[model samples]
Target: MTRAIALHQVSKAYGRAPRAVDNLSLSIAPGEFVVLLGPSGCGKSTVLRMIAGLEEVTEGELLLDGEPANHMPPSERGMAMVFQNFALYPSMTNRANIGFPLKLENPRQDHSERVESTARMLGIESVLDRYPAQLSGGERQRVAMGRAISRRPSAFLMDEPLSNLDAKLRNHLRAEIAQLTAELGVTTVYVTHDQAEAMSLGHRVAVMRGGVLQQVSAPREVYALPENVFVAAFIGTPRINLLRAVVHAPLDGRMSIDLGRQRLPLPEPLSAEHQLLRIQQGRDLIVGLRSEAVRIAPPSHARPGEVALSGVVEHVEYQGHEALVHLNTGSQPAVVPELESARPQQAARRRRRAGGGGTGVGVLERLRERATGHVGGPVVSLDEPVSGRQDPHSPDRPGLMAGDLVVRTGPDMRLRRGGQVPLLVDLEHLYVFDQQGRRICPLPRDVPGLDV
Candidate 1:
């Protein structure tokens, strides 16, 4: 029997430290696969532990199959966990390790048949009699999975189980795990720092940052409609091009975003998305363009909703199928600190200073308020005055002289470094983020009562 899991405003704190998991609420349906995706120290594993009954929930509720289960013991949760380290008994043979859990659960009954069946399912039957040290890494992990499968648990909690394996092996096992879980039809909560794994394996991906849930959606939606600057920067290959821009929406003139040396003019017939830029007139905002959004073409070849920009090529990385062209567009790149790690204490202090005490609003409501600019949100703009002088260049790219934009193109196009290239940007695919890092353009479909 599959189980449903839900967390309502669940939080975890250690002494005076900032919350490890802060007011996180999510629901997982029976037999659904959900992935908890974040960087290290972001509390994804803490969440998994809480769900498995290994960690205490310091605040709020944890429901198992719609019943409160905060104090339930780990063994009683009917969940199987696959750990990163494989966690096998060194002194025991693979067969003994797989059968150990069954022996403890029912010592009087013989589990040899079940153990053999599980081993066969994982294709590890040949290695059952050998010690863990004698088997390959993949074989050992298969044995561990065999052990978990023998239990027939209601839910599966996997904590970076493929992190220790080689790239090829990890990919192979990732497919196997997906197939195996689908065959079993068990509710699964997987934790991973790798975005590739999260996008590939999850039916729904929940992105977390500094213990706070950022965005949760299907993989395609998460990629296409990121809710904030962080989500836009974190999920894509080659990363999205984020440029500091100023919206100029003069009443008598065309609306445009001004980069350092170029201006992207919005087409004469302002789109509903572009019309909203009037609210941001003369204000600093971040503009996002995925690699696919821009093409290496001239202004005359511009398609409808396309704008023109020019850049000097700085570097070219030729992958087999395509090439990533890094160009100097004379545009400043917005720096998001600690993109791969968590800083809960600083975030917590910011919240307190901003009077971030619970407003009793749900997550969707809060997101809508930020996106619509109807309510104040966290301001993260380059124009904001600060106490200390900051560098003009991004720390991630030094000595490139504003090589801040990257565009993907066909591998067959041979371009020389320092060559000036004309580009066409599809305005229909443009993204705009306010000073608060909230996406403003392409308004969320669910937000209502907004004047176009």
Candidate 2:
């Protein structure tokens, strides 16, 4: 059985420190596989916990199948949660671990047949008799999953279930999870910081940050057209290249974008949506390009709706099928401050909890401390538009400039370090965001269930 899920203006706060999840609204169709993806401590897990009734909804409504479900306990909600840490009992055998919940739910009924069926479904029949301590990480996870499915809940909620495993095992288990959920046809909400996992497995991916839903869309839509700088930066491999640029209004009946040392001429007669660039002329903006957006080519090789930019190769990372070419394109990087700050916040939280908990300071005070390492310090670009604003604390420039951007290219190309290369930019694929990190270029219409 599957049920639709909805969060209307949901917010979660610890004490009165603003919201961990701020006015987030989402709707998941029945049997949908949705991934809650973001860096650590971005409130993805908190949202999952709320759905499972493990956490209270401080504000807003949680609807399960169009019924208010906020007050429903975990067991009554018919939702099974697979935790990050394998929460199997140390003393229980794999069979006992898988059947424990059903056994406890109704002691009179024999759970052995159901337990055996689930173990067989997970391909863990060989390990069913072994104790959890005797099984490997992957085997233990299978048992944990078996337990979740044994009860056959209406929904499956996974909170970074593969984070503890090695890469090989993570990949293996990820595929298993995807296949198992689809086979069960259960409404599945999975949480992970691994973009690769989300892209490959989720029917729709919800990108979150600072407790806010950034973008929720099909994986291809999320990647090809990110809703903001944060999504663009977080979703792609080698990260999307973000650089400050000045939009040049139409001159000689054609427009151009000035990327400091390089300029790209727009095709004659800009599309109506792209004509918005005229208003942005002379305005500072951020340009986003995926590794695949730019290729090693000259103007002659430029396709229609493409521009040429020259970059000096600083380094090359040879992947099996492709190479990540780090190039100095003379564009100031538009770093996503949120991703940069997540690690520090996580580290600080771990340390502070170890020290002891207390009522926290206001949001402004917290952001200020995180921004400047001092309380009551003036906040920087975080509160306002970063568009066109130069970094006030830029490090002194050395005599030489290395690649501040990485471009994906085919691995067969022989490119040496310090070599100059011309890259063709797909004008249609470029993304432009304002100083506030919101996507402005391509002029995306409202995506369904995507919060502004």
Candidate 3:
């Protein structure tokens, strides 16, 4: 039978600040699969541990089948856990490892029958006599899982169990694990730092950052309609592009982002959920543009509100399907368009509050000083945000800027580091953010069937 898991206001801490798993409230239905995903150290594992009773919860409650399980010990929780490291006994043969849990729980069962059934189910019958030392990594992992499943725990909590294997092995095992879970119809909560794994393995993915749950939805929903900037930045590959922008009128219409020298219009309209932190033409606002939103448009055919910039290619990382261009803007170091753009506006606002005025560079330096807690460092001396952009146009465009801009191009585009290329920013894909780093507008609808 399937069993669900719940965590209400669950939190954990190390000292002054929380280490991982903050105020995280989530419910996984019976037989549902959920993957907790984020960058390493973002607390994905902590949440799984808390659910499994492996880690102590600083505050809040954990529930199994609607019963509070926080104070209960791991063994009493009726849950099984799998770890990234394959914890197997070297002395035990495969048969013994798979049957260990069953033997411990019900010592009266005939060992050969239980062991034979599980070994056949896992297709590891031939390996039953082999010790862990004789088995490969994948074989050892299967043994660990087989042991966990022997007693039929109500739910399974996996903490990157496939992480220790090579990529090919991981792929093969992921399929096997999915098939096994489906056959068992067990509720599962998995944690991983890899987006690909989370996307493929889970029915839903819960994204966490710095111990806080950001968004919990189906894998595609989390990717297409991220609730905030952190989710948008953390979930996608070619990481969503964030540029500095300003909000414009036609309040009910699409969000109009003003790049420093150009203006781009969003294809998706903004919702109230978009928290507008700052809105000024010359002031700073973070604008998000996914790599796929950028295009290599001919200068003559460029549409109005489209942003055009010229930069020499600095470096290109080739993925089989696409190539990520790393441009050197010679102004800001490869600042993620979303995270850093808001700093300038916040700085400007602070300066305006303090009655000071200078250039963007000065304001940026002061903000850096305030951030780093150092008083007299050369803030403007920071490396250019991107490399290769030697000459950017200086037109009086709305959203155009001269700092950092990343252009996502097709793999076959074939441009060298020193070659000058003209890039176009699809303003329709822009993401705006407030001062607190929350998204100021709804993200572009990358997939259909989503409301916003």
* Candidate 2 C-alpha lDDT tens digits along 1-452: 89899999998999956467888999999999999999887799999999999899999999999999989888889989898899999888888899999988999999899999998999999988889889899999888999999999999999999999999999999999989998999999999999999999999999987788888999988987788787888988888888888888856656888877778788877787678878888987888888888889988988888888888777889889888999887677765655665775677667665554543544544555565432112111333332443322234533335566788878899997766788899988788887667788877665455442
Runs in model 2 with CA error above 4 Å?
250-253, 341-400, 445-452
| lDDT for each residue of candidate 3 in 128-172, tens digit (9 for 90 to 100) | 998999889998888888888877888998989999999999999
lDDT of each: 0.86, 0.83, 0.70
Better of 2 and 3 by TM-score: 2
lDDT of 1 by residue, 89-138 (tens): 99999999999999999999999999999998999888899999999899
Q: How close is every model to the real structure, measured as TM-score?
A: 0.87, 0.87, 0.77
Q: What is the lDDT of candidate 2?
A: 0.83
Better of 1 and 3 by lDDT: 1
lDDT value for model 3? 0.70
Model 1 lDDT, full chain set: 0.86
